[model samples]
Target: MGLSDGFARPLPTLVFAVAAALSMAGLELAVKQIALGTAYAVWVGIGAALTVGWAMATGVEPASPLKLLFIAGIVGCAAGLKLLPSGGSAAED
Candidate 1:
């Protein structure tokens, strides 16, 4: 029960880090397609929802109120992104 023996005596966390890096490629492609405004919004929303879904899908936990709350926050972020001024506007600021 120590901090340095999680995976065979400090077996590197490199695998996880590498996966994270590769994952970014797909993420970046998705974001680039639908435009940062919409793509990012959808990505965040989907990510949150899917995370909970995956947890449940794997029999970790059942759906709950907290999941609904995250969805709401996702919606709010989408709306805010839309309402906010997008960069590279024609008018000087």
Candidate 2:
């Protein structure tokens, strides 16, 4: 799409872009308060899942069983990190 295209100019898209940027900032803060491994995994997993979901929902991309399963795997791994007893706390050193 061109820079001035109608699809590119939507307010919601701009809002979402801003939200995504803010979430990245939040990820940096989270790494300071929590273990980097856990924070980074959750940040990347959530970002990927949301991006795929939005693409599918908007019909920008097609959804298939495998795609859904893959997203589930990503989110599950992130959840697993949070459940680990040692990884949820602030990092040492």
Candidate 3:
């Protein structure tokens, strides 16, 4: 969304670039402490849930009970992933 909105706007483009860079950096740091698959799933799940939530909040998308339920499910799954063992010791980080 940010990237699409940025197509002819300077500020939005810059913001999108910075946000993408930061997201990647955070993902890189996360993989150091967790399994790659778990980290990636949590990262993508949170990002998707938040994006949809924001759209609903700002009225860019219509809000519905089903949407909210799915968002909760996504959040729950991400949290569950975090709770699972990573098959590595914390000291490995």
* TM, every model: 0.44, 0.69, 0.81
Best by lDDT: 3
- Per-residue alpha-carbon lDDT of model 2 for 1-93, expressed as tens digits? 223365567776677667868998989997886688779988889889988998899888999999999999999998887666663344541
11-79 per-residue lDDT for model 3 (tens digits):
777777787898899889889988899999989998899889878998889999998999999999998
Clashes of 3: 0
Candidate achieving higher lDDT, 1 or 3: 3
Q: Model 2's lDDT to the true fold?
A: 0.80
- Which one is best on TM-score? 3
Give the whole-model CA lDDT for all candidates, comma-separated: 0.62, 0.80, 0.85
Against the correct fold, how does model 3 do in TM-score? Answer: 0.81
- Please list the residue runs of candidate 1 whose C-alpha ends up more than 4 Å from where it truly belongs after superposition: 1-19, 64-93
User: Which 10 consecutive residues of model 1 have the lowest summed lDDT?
Assistant: 1-10
